[model samples]
Target: MSVLAHLGVEITSSTDDSMDNRKRPAASPNSGSFVFWSSSFRRQPARVLIVEALPPWWSDTCTVLCDALDNFLSLACNLDGPSRIPLLSLYAVSRQQECVLPFVQVRGNLARLHSCVEELRSIPGEGCIKGAARGGELLRQAVLDSLQQFKQYIRHISTGNQTNNNLSVEITVVTSQPGPGIVRQLEMGLKDADLVSLKRLLVVQINSVGDWGQDTPSPETTYTEAEESLMLGTEVELLRMENSVFALETMLKAWLQEQGGDREHLHLLLPSPTDSPNPVCVKCDMQERLISPALIPLTPNLGVKTESVRDFLPVTKASANQNQPPQRLKVIKLLRADGLCESVLYGLPLVIRPTTCWQLDWEEMETNNNLFHALCHTLRGRDLFLLLQVEPAGGSGVYSHYVLQSSTSLSLLLKPVVSRELLLPCSMPVSPQDPVPDAMQTVQCCLTQLDEEFVFNPLSLTNNLYQHLKSRGLISQPRYPYRLQPAAVLRDQSQPPEGAKTTGSRQPRQVKPHSFLQQCEGHEVT
Candidate 1:
């Protein structure tokens, strides 16, 4: 009967003769009790325990653990599905006795853990066991014993269905003072349990006091050993943390990396400094030199604020639209005699009136337009004419002339000329009474004078003429060839003669003359 039952056979008759003669059909393996047990076992919840080997007074060890736990809880709360809640346990080891806090799924468990850690925090070093010489050994023994008991409990529960057992267990051991023996023992125990398939095993070493030496085992040793001991799918991390928020961030990033979480995209929500009732002044000599208030440091210590995970959904959505191309406006190219050009576009309200003419208010211009400022600076104290060309949709061009005026703000104040003929012959005059000589005529005269002074190379005549004209300010800076537009000529008998003046307009008014050529000549025209 026992053999038949093992083969998934059911027996109705109890007589020994009938049992010996009974025959039952073989059942499928998937329908057996073992398969059911395996499926049920795989669905079991995960268990995580944070084990602290060092005492509370060991250089902010307790505080670091509590901060880590708070980060973990924040991560849990932000989880999307049913995995948000995890079964958590805490254990604290000391020379006197080991304290085991059982796993609980209640909301108050975190509060209880915080209170327990605080109570442990209040206990001074004098209250601890006086066996300072054997403290490291005792702590190692306690950790080994606890791991052994945990393994035994798991094994005992999985006695009958050992092949189908799929429970996952994770233990995070955080310590500042780890004995060499403890690390070796952990390495050996984890190596032997490779087939048991533990979920995760992380060892965090806090170096608050900075006493690492030959006696103390380094984190690299544990990391290399743990990598070799753990199963292919299992995770093992060996982290070392200093007393800083950046160190804690590194630890959390490592933890999330093992779980296949997006480490780079996560943001930490820190408490706002504005929450304090009184304003605090943070002083720094280097920061004081910066003009922007946003660049100044608000506090020297960032660890005072608690950190939590801010979800990535809203941040992702906000950034998704951030990279849209900037809107472009229609702009006209304004070229200068110096070969420097600027793009003119309206960024503010453009008003054209008889009073203001085409005055551009510098204060109203966009502060970001650096080209405008550069053009304004270059055009200062110079007489220039702008040839305005507008191409209409009918493929016809409309042309006009505007005298470019420089103001105190160095902005362009364009005064439109009534006749396009005014643009001809480069309308800048050396003085009110004396019109500036034509650029070609001036270049010819300068070349003749240079020829008289010294026998000049015939091949260098054009170059020498440009240099001479540029020095005389007849040609502008950069010395490009200046071409004079043809003057308007009438081809009718009734039209006025070439030099005739119209009757309606008053005679050209002469203002106080300020000659740029006179100033250049005073400086020897060099």
Candidate 2:
């Protein structure tokens, strides 16, 4: 969360090629504790600039923008994590561009943002001043100019040596210009702009309710042509909202959350050679994949919602220490799988993905990525698991976890394990009676037929309640939200899966799989 690379010492004392290593609390193995990596890298905070592209002097549009900004600031302040906050700026384009506010971190500068909204509201709407820039040309100029300003700011930061000038730049353009013609012209202008790509740009188009129809909600639209026009790395997301201020504010808030409202970050040390003193570490974003459900207190009125009871409940000293020491993933040991193993999971499950730092050189970033991929590959290929000492973020206790490959990417599952000594003796006999040969053969045949007949997709699973609420219009859903995915090895243990289909001939599946083993069947114990 802390982009302290610029503040920390260099990784090595003698070499210039060695990168800067941000200092963290190192775990001492000599004390019978975990041995954690002392060095780490983190992605720079996102620099986002919101562009107002409504027609000049349009009071109604300006008022909506101001209200939306106010609500957005309020919502952002209530978020729990400070590290996920992005630096936000705003620019209004009329006959000429207006810098309503420079880039400022949203968490502590809420008052400044509120004042900026007031300033936006005070702008006199003269209703389409003569000879003012309008349409796609105006938008084109605004985007190009914004990019130039971002580059200038980064250069200035580098000159000042305050921090690494590697911040992720994102520009969100909110325009009330209705119709597809504006989008088409914008695409053409972008194609001619010398820039390579606009991957970080987001264009939100607001339209009137009457334009789409009064009975049905407007459908979201994407401008694939706009993305293609600029050779962007990712598809351009085009969000359409009705003219209602409430709807605009609600949609904008949801978009900001999707950017990264719920993620917590940690540095994971990759497995290094025993002789090497320092191991390669990469930045990772941790997210709650599965959380325990809690009973919500009922409210007397539908408009009045109940807040979390945790506020009224007592807060322990541990919970109050929001700025706890940063967490590190340390490999305690590696063991070969003998047979089926069982472990208990008692806390919320987390999914971790190794993220690339933009500040590092291309080769260095690739090396870190490759290291993570290789680690996961070895664990899955050799039928092995890693014993890790993990400290969960925003919680107490040091829990041991069995780290296994969770997906094709450098994403791993940390399943909490309890000590064997805590379990009592089994009530039944240690060994079961041998199965009949005839029955074993029949079961094997059935399993084989089922495997061949259907190809399993782990992504099919979804939270029923969440989806139900979304479908019932009770919740707003992002166009592309995160979903859980099982590793390729889980689909077929014999060989790696290809294009969601297994290629190897069917073999008798293990009757009792290890708790960490994700079976081909849809069933999962934890």
Candidate 3:
């Protein structure tokens, strides 16, 4: 209940936001795919018009994206494609009311790209996506990839929003059009999106407020309606967003570089008439960071380094006091007194808000992950339990911290406990924080060594591995490592020194750790 109270967004949990033709569905996911299909009550060709938030540099993105997709599709057609093709944005939405879910929308410009998969090219305004500052880029590529894959089904797509940074694509379906017949041609294409909103939500009625908690498991509320629509995410993204602005400035300076002809008042995202840096994608940097671990260590780079300062202490009598056993986290078990949480029988939705934490004691310690993994491995068939620790650090509140064991069966997550609370704390933030206590007041789960080895997710066990690397002197999670490149729009003057490479300067090869041990002591990395 208090989880969002500190954030200052006063939400009426039980309040209903229902309308005449619409009844709010129960919650499923915070992030969901929408699929929409429209057969007009009055048979008529759906004329789609795009709306963009009107800004100094607004609909320009729509024009640039539409034209770019058009040109790309034109190029794709040369390779021999299907008889028909359409281009559309996979995650586009109509007026907010059209689809009643967050982060789900209609196709953007489906008219030109959906005809042939081979002919599908640019995803409109896709390069403008971002995530949380620390983990913002986490889901950007996934979203982009989904868009590209959906391009083949875009029969007609365009934008209409112009007062903000959001991009819109209004789609209409009428049988009189020349393209392929409805249904068979678009069954898979419209699985989770609407002709006007998202393809995923087309036929699926999602819960209104519950979608965020159920549909999307992503932690960051970083995706919002403001700059979120533009993707300048985090304080880290501000600089890059500004670079995009600068690139727009350069295009304004001249007018013949884009289409090889002078077209005054060009779109912001299009190549400017001026010879500024070609528009490099804001998300193009993703290729290098795949399979990258999220939890980074500070001192030297070993992540989740359980290798504490005590590891180095000798066996002398004086050292015994200094080398105490790694403290055990407090344990509180949240048992579901009522069956409200453990039941997931049908497609009917369920919301599992916490009343308290479940606890377990740490009898001993071992560095095996077989016991903790959630997906595949030894625990695939059996119901595997995992722990989620909720803490109160930023503000002093009475939300007692406890532990609850959750299991996934039949594709739905269920907890046996609903009416319990536990109070716990840690010496540090689950993320980054100022450490005041050496000992963590954790309410952790207890698993046997064999149970842990066979069940734990190897990734979770390696949590302490971050500090292991750091002690040896390795860089932590460098999502935005020092050098910042705003956009390709700037000249040598605008890029950070790291982004700049002189012709004579040989790019140094990254030194891989000879062994995890050596990297621990090789050099200092923050």
lDDT of each: 0.38, 0.48, 0.25
- Candidate 2 lDDT by residue in tens digits, 1-526: 1101111111211111111222222323332122121222133334454555443425557767677668767655433221234456677776667777775556546788888878777767665543222444666677777667766765676565466523556667776555354455455556556454233556677763223223221222234654545643433457676667676665554333223323445676554434445654556753221111111111211111112223212223555536333345568878665442442332223455656656689888888888888887787777676776654332433243444423445666554443331121222346578878975654454444332426456577676987787787644654422222347655555465566665457574444454434454456567
Off by over 4 Å in 2: 1-57, 77-80, 129-133, 160-166, 194-198, 209-236, 254-526
Q: Per model, how many backbone clashes are there?
A: 0, 1, 147
TM-score of each: 0.33, 0.40, 0.17
Q: What is the lDDT of residue 209 in candidate 3?
A: 18
Best by TM-score: 2
Error of 2 at 202 (Å): 2.1
Give the Cα-based TM-score of candidate 3 against the true structure.
0.17
Residue 185 lDDT in candidate 1: 40
The order of the candidates by TM-score, greatest first, is 2, 1, 3
Candidate 1 Cα errors over 4 Å, as ranges: 1-57, 78-80, 106-109, 123-166, 178-181, 188-197, 210-213, 216-237, 252-526
Give the better candidate number (1 or 2) by lDDT: 2
Q: Mark the 10 consecutive residues where model 3 has the least summed lDDT.
A: 285-294
Q: State the weakest 10-residue window (summed lDDT) of model 2.
A: 1-10
